[model samples]
Target: MIFRSLADIEALERTPCEQAIAARTTYGLIERAARLHGARDAFVYLPDGELDTAPQRITYAELLANVNRAANLFRSLGVGPDDSVAILAPNIPSTQYALWGAQVAGRACPINFMLQPEHVAGLLDAANAKVVVAFGEHAQLDVAGAVRRIPGIEQRQVLWVSAPGAPTPALSQRANEAVFEQALAAQPDSLQFDPRLSPERIASLFHTGGTTGAPKLVQHTHGNEAHTSWFAHMFYGFDENTVEINGFPLFHVAGAFVYGLAMLAIGATQVLPTVLGMRDAAFLRNYWKFCEREKVGALACVPTILAGLCNQPVDADIASVKVAYTGGSPLPTELADRFEKATGIPVRNILGMTECSGLVSIEPLHAPRVPGSAGLRMPYSEVKIREDGVVALRGPHVSPGYTDAARNAGMFEDGWLVSGDLGRIDAQGYLHVTGRAKDVIIRGSHNIDPQLVEDAFLAHPGVAMCAVVAEPDAHSGEVAMAFVTLKPGASIAGDALLAEVAPRVYERPAIPRRVVVIDTLPVTAIGKVYKPALRLRAIEIKLQELFASQADGREIVVTAKERGSAAVADVRIAGAEDPALAARLQAALGAIAVPVAFSFS
Candidate 1:
C-alpha cells in the first residue's frame, strides 16, 4: 500500500497528492491517509503465482471501512477501550486487519502460536483478553479444557476461523458463535475514530523468553511503539518504494514492531509469503525465487534461518536486496561473513528486547565489523553501563514494568530498564555483548563464561552450532562441557572439538574438559538456545565412560601448600590421570589457598 505522501515519486510535474505531510504518530499516518487516498492500494498479497499475476490489493478505503466495521462488531460484543483482544496467526493479511481493528477499539495482543498450552494460558490471563481470535486447529485454544484449568478465561469468549465449509471447533462453534472470516466478510469495509492518542495507552503486551526466571509481560504504549517503528524506518532508510519481505513470526516485539510496523509507517510494500516450514528445501527455494521476482529490498533473519538458506547453492537474483538486518541472538561471525559475501548485502546486527519495543541499537551499514556486537545504540535511545556491569536504558520506547508485581521487581532499577544482557561499550562506541551474567560459570576458582566458549566453537568450520554448559563437579566445583552440532554431511569427533577449544582456552581453567556430539541444540521460539536445559542434561552425562575403564571406585585429591610468604590452595581429582590436567589446575588457582592434603577414595 502506498500512502499519498509517497505517491508523488512517479509524477514529474507538481502532483495534486504531493502536500507537506505531518502526523502525530505512525498510526495517525495510517488512519488519516484513508480520507484522501481511500481507494489507493494499502496492502498487496499473493497466495500463489508471481508478484505481477493477480495479486490481492486491499485499498486504504476498504481497510478503513473494514476496520470500522470490525471495531463496531467488537464494541457490540462489549469490547471497549482498555479491553484486550489477542490474535494467533502468521503474517497473513487477516492478521494485520485483526490487530488494526482491535487497536481502533481497544488493546491488541498477538500471541505466538508455537508456544505450548500453559505458555499461551499465561499470556491470555496476563492480557485479560475478553476475546481470543485463533485458527480452528490451534491446540492451545481448547476452550472447554481452558475454562476448567485457567480461571481467568472462565467466561471469556473464543472466536475460531476455519476453511470456508469445514466444521469448526466443537466447543465455540457448535452454537454458531462468531467465526473470524465470517465476521470480516459480513462487516462493511470502512470506519473512522477520533484521534486523541497518548503514549501511556497500552497497545500490546509481549512476554520474553526468560532464561533465568519466568517470562514477564512487557507492556508497550501507542507512543512507545510508534516512536520505535519510526526510529526503525529512519535507521533502516526505508521509503515508500521499498518492498520488504517478512517471514519472521509476528509475535516478538522485534519482528512485529521493528520490521512489520516499520514497513507500514514508511508506506512500503510488505510481502507476506506462504506459511511454510522454514527448513523445507522446497520452501526455501521457492521463497528465494519469490524474493527475486518481487525484488524485495529489505529483509530480516535469525542466524539459524540464514544458515538453512546458505546450506545449498542458490544463484537467484538476490542482487536487488540492499539491507539484511539480523538479530534476536548473536549471529555466528562465520555465518554473517558468508551471508554478506554471497548475497552482496551487509548484515546489520541489532540489539533489543520485548521490553524496549524491539530495537535499541543498530550497527549501521557503514560501521566497521565487530565480532559479536549487537551494534551501537539507536538515535532515540540512551544506554548506560551500570556499575554492576549490566546494560540499562531509558527511552520513550521503553515499556513500564509488567503488570505482575513480583515479576516487575527485578526487571527495573530506579527508572531505567535493567536489560539482562551483559555487555560493554568500547571507547569507539561499539558494543560487545559477551553473555548473560547469570550464565557465567566458575570452576576451580576459574571463571568460564559460556559465550567465550561458544565463540571458540563457532570458529571451527565443521561445527555448525555449539553450546557450552557448566556440569557439576565435586573436584573443581564445576567443569565446562561442550555440546557441538556438526554441519550436514560433516563428521567431527568429540576429541576434535576438545582439541580445538583446548588451545584457545588453555590459559584459563574454563576450557572444556569433555566434549559431546548432539544432532542439534534445543532452541526457543525466538531462536535462542536453551542453555539452562543444556546444563541440566550435561550434569547427567558421564564423560568417564568414553575413556578406557578405570577402577570403579578410584579417586584422588591434591591439597594446597604454602609458597614463600604466600599460601596457595590446590585441588585435583583423577579417575585416569593425565599430568596435563594437574598442571592446568595448578596454574588456574595460583594464590587462592595452601595445598593441605591428598586423599584417594
Candidate 2:
C-alpha cells in the first residue's frame, strides 16, 4: 500500500501501461462505470444563489447516455481523434458532460474563461481547435467576445451552453453558433465509442507558463490521465461511497482532470458549488455547514481555499472528511497545522504541474507528514533532483513533451521532465520544494533563496502569507524583498515585524532589506503565489528609492542588466554636486558592496 523506496515502486508495476490499462481505457472506464453503477448518482449540481431550487443530479448511466449524445454531436461537427474541442464555460453539469464527450471523440481543450480574447485566440490556434463550446454569458467576462475572436472559427463551430435557469440564447438567429441542448437533442442516445485508442493518443491539451513569456500547450494522453486517476484512487482510497466537493474552476487542469474527470473515473459522486467557488462569500460562509449536509468524505482543495476556510470559525469538528488534498503551490506548515486543528481535516499538500499531467507526489494520507514537504513520489513515477536542485521526474504520467517545439529544449532531457521548481529529496525521500531556481536574489557573490526568507517571515505569529522576491540594489547588485499579509485583524507594523525576523535570518545577505505589508498576495488560478508580478513590483520600488537617494541630488538615468539570477543596476550621474555620490550610493544599497559601477549621463 506504501512505497518506501524505488524498489518498492518498481515492484508495483507489471508491464507498466500495458497492464495498467488492460481493464480500462479512458472512455471505456466510463462505459464500465455506467453499466456497473447505473443507479448511483455520479454528479450533483448544487445551487449558487438560489437555494430554493433542488440540486440537479445525474446517474452514472444518464451521464454516459448524455455524453454519448454529445459525442455524436461533436463528430457531426468534424471533431475526431487528435482534433481539439475547445471549451469555455463555468462549472456546470453540462460542461462536465461536454468534457467527457469531447474526449470520447477527440482531445479536450478547456480554456480559462477569465482569459482575454487575444489569449483565447492564441490557445485555439495552438491547439488547432476544430470547435469551441462556451456559455452565453458571464458576470465578470465577455464570453461572446472571446468566442468571436478565436481566429477563423465560424458560428457553426461554436456550441453555446446555457446557464441553469437562464432562457436559451437565440443561437439560430445568429448563423455562427448553435444551442448545445438543441444540437444534442437531434443526436441519438447512444454513439459508438472507439475502444481502440492507443495509450499514446492525446487526450487533453493544457497550457503551462513559459520561462520567458507565452504559455506552452502541454499534451496529456489517455495514458497520462488514466495513470494519474488510478494514482488518485490508490492514494485517496476512493470508492463508490466517496463523495467529493470540488471548488477549483472547471477550466483548470486540476479541476477538469483531477477533481471532475478523475472523480467520475472512480465512480464517485461530485458536488459543485454555486457559480463562484472560493470567492463566493456565501459559499465560503457556509462551507462547513454545506459539507456536513452533503456528507462530503473528501474535499478537493488548494492552499488558498484552505487558508481562507481556516479564517472562518467552525462550530464543531466533522469526522466525515477522510482527507483534503492541496496542491498547485507550497503549503505553509503553519497553515496546514492550523487548518487541521480548526476543522480536523488533514491537508495533504501535493506537488505537480500541467506538464506532469496532474500530480507526481503528495503528503501520504496515512503516514506522518513532513512539515514542509509535498510528499513521497507516487509509485507510478520516478523523481530526481538535477545537479542544480531542480526537481526532475520520469513517469508514464508525464506528458509527451509540449506541442511547441521551441519550448522543449532544456525542458526535458533524456526521460526526465525538467520541473522549474528548485527542491531536494530529503533523507527520508520526501520532496521538499525550496523555491524556483530562477526566482533567487543574487547579492554581490551570494545567492539568496527567497523561500528561505519567506519562511522566516511566515514564522511570525501575525503573518498569514508572504512572498520574498529580488530587488535591484545600487550597492549589493540585488537584495531580498518581502511582501506579506497578516492574520485577520492583526495590527503588527511592517518595520517592527521586519526587526523581529531580521536577526532570525541565518545570513546577513539572505535577510530581506525591504518589507511591505499588503492585505493579500496575488495568487494564480491554481492557488500558487504569482511571483513574476511580485518581482516586477520589487524592481519598481528599489529603483524609485535609488532615484531619490542620489548624494548630489543630480539627474541620473538607471537601467537594469540581469545576468543569471542577479539583477545589476547601472547608474549614470550628471551634474553631480558631490564627488562622494557613487560612494554614498554604494553605502545605501546594502551592508555588503554590490557589483555596481557609475558613468556620466
Candidate 3:
C-alpha cells in the first residue's frame, strides 16, 4: 500500500475500512503483530540518548506480554471498561505499556505532567481517573512531587514507575501506592478476562492543548485509533523492516498513535531517544549518528526539530534514511527545502489534530513534496474547505466529541470536525493550510493572514524561527507584529531585519507593524511556538505604550494573563486611583479584544 496520491488512498478505501483493517482495537492490532513477528524488535530505547550507549530492546512478543501484564494489573485494580487510567510519564517503555494496557482494560488518559499540579488534578478529576500510573522522581521533572500534590489522589490506586537503575524516591507510605514493577510482575502474562473490544468503545481521553480555555479532553474510540494508526502506517510505506526514531512525548497523539502505535502495529521498530525525549541536547546533537547506527529507515520529528537538524552536521552514514516526516506546527516552505537540500532525505509534511487521533493528512512517502501543502487527506475521510476557508473533516478516525460536550460547540459541526485551520484543497486534492482561522490579524475590516508575515521574515537567512501575532492597536483594533529568533552566530538589528523583509510581504496590511528579536521563542512541550504567550506579550506592550502618557509620573505596570478562557490585561497604577484617569484608560483599552482591569497601588 504505497500511497503516492489521493487516488491510491481512495483505491484502498474501496474495500471499506471495516474490511481493510483486520484488527479494530489497539490490543488486537498488537496481538496480530506479535503473532506474525514475534522475534522482531518492537522498540529500541536509548537510556541516556547517547549513540554509544547500550540500548534496551523489546521484541514484539515481549511487548505484547508486557501489555497483557499491565492490562491485567489495571483490571485487578478495579479499572473497568468505562474507568480511566491516568498516566504521567515521559517516553519510557513503561509509559507505552501503561498507555496501551489501559486502553485494553479501560480508558487511558495521558496527561501532560509538565502542567501545574492543579491543572493536572483538574484533568484527572474530569476523566474520573480511578488509577494513576506515574513516573518516580527524576532530576529533569518532579513527577513524584506532582503526583503527591494532586488532591484526593491518595484515595485512588497509584503505581509508580522508575527507569531501570534509577533510585526510587522516598515518600510517606500510603496504602494505595505500590511500585509499578512489583505490581506488574505479579500479574499474569496474558489477558485474564475478555476485553469486549468494540469499535465504538472509548479507548482513550486525550487532552487538547487549546490556547485560551481549560484544555478539552478528546475521546478517541478504538475505531478512531485503529483507523488512524493503520492509515498512517500505510501512508508512511512502513513494513516489518521499517525503523523510525521517535522522541515525541506519549501524551501527544503524534507520539502515541501516529509515529508510535503506527510503527508498532506492523512490528516496525521505533527508537526511543530517552526519558527527556527530543529536549535532550546531547541526543539531538548525536541524532543522525544514532539513526545511522540503528539503520533507521524513517525519521519522525516536528518542524522545529527539522529546523534544528538543518544546523546539525550529518556526520554519519545516513544512507538508510529514506525520508523525514514533520508536523505539530506549520511547516515553513523555506525550512523544509533547506533541510532537504542539506540532507538528501526528502521532508514530508503531516497535518494532524487530537480530535482525529492525531492524523488528518500526511504527505505519502512515495509522493513528491508539494510546496505550501500539508498533503492529502486520510483514506475514506472527507475533507472540505468551507466558504470561510475553515478546513472540516469527517471520517472514521474522527473522535465522537470532547469529554466536555460544551467545548465541542464550534469544533464538531454535524458529522464534521472543524479544524479551525484556514486551508484550500487544490484541484489535485492537496490541502494547503494557509493559516489558523483564529490567528488571522484583523485591521479595521481587513483580514490579514499571519503566515504571510511569518513567511516573509523566515525568508531571511539570519532568522531561525519566526512567529507573527496580532498586536492590540486602538486605531485599527489589531495589527500584525512579528517575533523572531535568529540562527546561531547570526546577528541583525530588528529594524534592519524588518526593513529587509517587509517588502517581501505582498499584502500591505499583512506586513508586520514591528519586529521583535528575542533569544528564544516560547514553545510548548513538543516545540510548537506558543502563540498565546506571544499574543499576551503583544497586548502588554500595547497597553504599556497606551498608558505611558496618562501615568503622569505615576508608575504604570501592565501584565497580561488568561482569566478562564479570556485574555485579561491588568493595569496597576503606583499612586491613589483617579476616577478621571481610570475612566480615560478604560475607554481607550475597551477598543482592544483583551479585557482590561485597573488597579491602584
Candidate 4:
C-alpha cells in the first residue's frame, strides 16, 4: 500500500494488523520472504567500499540458511531462549546472520563498538550475555583488544568474524574461543530445534542513552520488532525489487531494524559499504557513482550526511534514486531543501526511538515533504501530544520497557511511551517536533527552546551547522549560547554572524548571548549533534569570562567534568593561594547553575 497521508494509513488499519500481516515474529517474516523470493539478492556487500571493486551478494535462501545454521550453533553453545548473544561488529553479512540467528535461538544484543571497554563490559554484564560475536583485528578498530579488556570475557563464549577475504586475527587459545566461520560451517543448514517463537518473546536488547553510568538496555519483543519492520516496509512501499544503500552501523536502531530488517523482510537488496560505512572517505567521494551502478531506489542517511552530500558534485546519473530517509537528529530545513534541489530526491524525516523498536512516525514516500513535521504516525499506532507538548506513543511497535524497570519511570506511563521530545500534533495528524524538553533554556521566568535559536542561525547561508545549548548565567539560571560551523570557504566573525541571524529569532530571550564559530560541531557516532559537550564548553566560556579580570600575571585555567548527574567546574589559579580571590571566584560561580570548585597552585 502507498501511504500518501494519515488518512491512507488509517484506511489500512480498518483490518486489524494481525489479520493484515501474517508473520508475527521476525523469524517468521524472514522465512516468509525467503519462501517468496528465495533466489532474490538479499544483501550486496562492498568489500572496499569502492565502485570498481566486485561486490559480494547473498541470496534470501542463503541468508535464511545461514541464519538457521548460526542459531543451531548458538544452541550447541548452550544458549537458551532467555539468554542473550552480544555482537560487536560493523555492517557485514555475517553480522546479519549472527543478529537474526541469535534472535531465533534467544535474544540478540548488538553493542556499539565505539564505546569504551568499561562501557562495553557494563552492557554485556547488564544483558547477561552468554555468547559474544566480535569482529577480528582490523587496521582501523581494535575489536580484539577491546574484547580482551572486558573483565570476565575470558569465561564467555567468543566467536570472531572478519570481512570477506580479510585474514582472521589469531587470539590466545581459550577453551571458549572459536573462529565464527569454522564454527558456523560445522552446523547444518536447517533448524536443529524448535524455537517455540512467540510474539511476546524478547527479540533483542538495544542499549540507549549515554554510556557513562548504568547502561539502558531497551527490550524489543518479537511483536514490537515485527510490527515496526512491517509498518516501515508498507509505509515506504518497499518490495523485492527495491535496492537501498545501508551504511548505518548494526548497533544503531535505524540500521538494525528500521532500515535493515525492514528491507530484508521484503527481500529487498541492501548495499552495505565497507566496515567504515559512510565514514569511508573514498566511498563518500564516489557515492553517486555507486548509486548509479547499484540502481539504488532508496537512500538511507542522517542530516550530517545530507549536508556532506550537498557539497559532493553530482558526477553520475542518479535518476533511479527516488527518496532519501534521514533521522537520528532533527532535519534542518535548509539542508533538506539544498539536498533536494541538488539531487532532486525527496528527503523524508523519521521520528524513532530505541524504546519504539526504531519507529514512531515516518514521512511516507508517497507524501510531499512537510516543512517541520516528522510525518504521520505508523498505521494502527497511537501518537498524541501531551498538554505540556511532550509527544506520547503507544502501539505494537512500542517496546514494553527497559530491562531495568527503574529506568522506565518517566519514559513509560501505563501503556504510552512518554517521548521526551517537545512537539505538537497538527490538525492534519502531522507531528511537528519543536525541541527536546530537557534542551529548553530557562532565563529567569522565561523558557526558551534551543531550536528557535538554531533555526535562526541556520537560516543564514554561511552557517553549515548550528547547535544552541544552555549557558550558565549569574542573574538568570541559564541562557542560550550557539556554536556553529561555517560552510566551506565561508568566513564571518562570530559577532557579525550573530547580528545577522538575531533578527530571525522572534523571541528576544531565546536569542543567544554568545556565538562561537568552530570548524566542526561535536556529533554522535550516528551524526546527531552532541549537546552535552557544547554545554560544558559554554560553562567553561562563562567562567573564563567571569574570572578574566582577576588574572594579574596569573594563568587562569577552567575545566569542566560531569560528576554523576551534575556538571562540576574546576578553576585553577597559577600562583600563591589568595583567600580573597578564591572567595570572590567561589561566590561568583555559586550563583551560576553548575557548581564550581576553586584550586590555586
lDDT (CA) per prediction: 0.64, 0.76, 0.88, 0.89
For model 1, how does the per-residue alpha-carbon lDDT over 1-601 read when each residue is reduced to its tens digit?
A: 1212111222311422113222424456566656655665556555443444455676766666666676655655667667878777655566667776776667778876665566777778777777876656433233334433444444566665542223554454334246676677776655444534565677777777543334667787876777667656645667767787676666777557777777666566666654322433444656667678778888777776666656646667877788778877776677778777766777877787888888777666544556677776654457888787888888767887776767776677677888877789886566677777667777877777777777777677787777887765656767788998887888879997688667776356778878889987877655667776676566435322311133233443333233432333333355556555545444443343224222222
lDDT of 1: 0.64
Report clash pairs, candidate 3.
none
The predicted structure with the larger lDDT, 1 or 4, is 4
Error of 4 at 600 (Å): 3.6
Clashing pairs in 4: none
Residue 94 of model 1, lDDT score: 62
**97-176 per-residue lDDT for model 2 (tens digits):** 78878887888888886666767778898897888898776553357666666656563388888766666755545565
Residues 304-343, model 4: lDDT tens digits: 8898888889999999998999988788787788889889
For model 1 the TM-score comes to 0.79
TM-score of 3: 0.97
Considering summed lDDT, which 10 consecutive residues are worst modelled in model 1?
1-10
Better of 1 and 3 by lDDT: 3
Model 3: per-residue Cα lDDT at residue 269? 96
Clashing pairs in 2: 155-176, 155-177, 156-176, 475-594, 476-594
**Model 4 per-residue lDDT at 445:** 86
